[model samples]
Target: MSNSMKVSFCCKDCKRKMFDYYAGILNLYIKCNRCKRVLTLKKIDEKYVAERMINGKLFV
Candidate 1:
C-alpha cells in the first residue's frame, strides 16, 4: 500500500477549509479559496501537514 495520506487545507486569513483532498505532502504553492492568499505546503509530519500562510507564519 502507498504511504500517502489524504488531508485538508485551511486558509489562515479566513480560516476556511479548502474543497479538494490532497494526498501526500508536497513542497508546492497553493492559493487559499477564501482569502485568495498564496501559501506553501511546507511539510508533512507523522500525522499532520504544516502550511505557510501569507503572513509568513506557519500553521498546522
Candidate 2:
C-alpha cells in the first residue's frame, strides 16, 4: 500500500471552502478542486493529517 498525505483547499480570492484531496504535507502546494486555486496545504490542521494516515476508516 502507498502512503499519501491529506489536504484541504480554500480559495485565495474569495476564501471559500474548496476541496479535500490526497496530498503530501511535505510538498509545498496543492490545487483547489472547486476554485481551481493553488494553495499550501500546510495551512490546514494537523488533525486532518493524523486522520488521513490512519486506518481504513476515518470516521466511526
Candidate 1 segments exceeding 4 Å error: 1-7, 19-23, 47-60
The local distance difference test score of model 2 is: 0.49
Give the per-residue lDDT of model 1 (tens digit) for 1-60: 124534455665787765434445556687776678887666554344334333323332
| Each candidate structure's count of clashing pairs | 0, 0
The TM-score of candidate 2 is 0.29
Say which candidate scores most in TM-score: 1
In order, candidate lDDTs are: 0.52, 0.49
Question: Tens digit of lDDT per residue, candidate 2, span 4-53?
Answer: 64444446565565555463444457565655767664453455656553
lDDT of 2 at 42: 48
Candidate 1 root-mean-square deviation in Å: 7.0
Tell me the lDDT of model 1 at 44: 52
Runs of candidate 2 exceeding 4 Å displacement = 1-4, 23-60
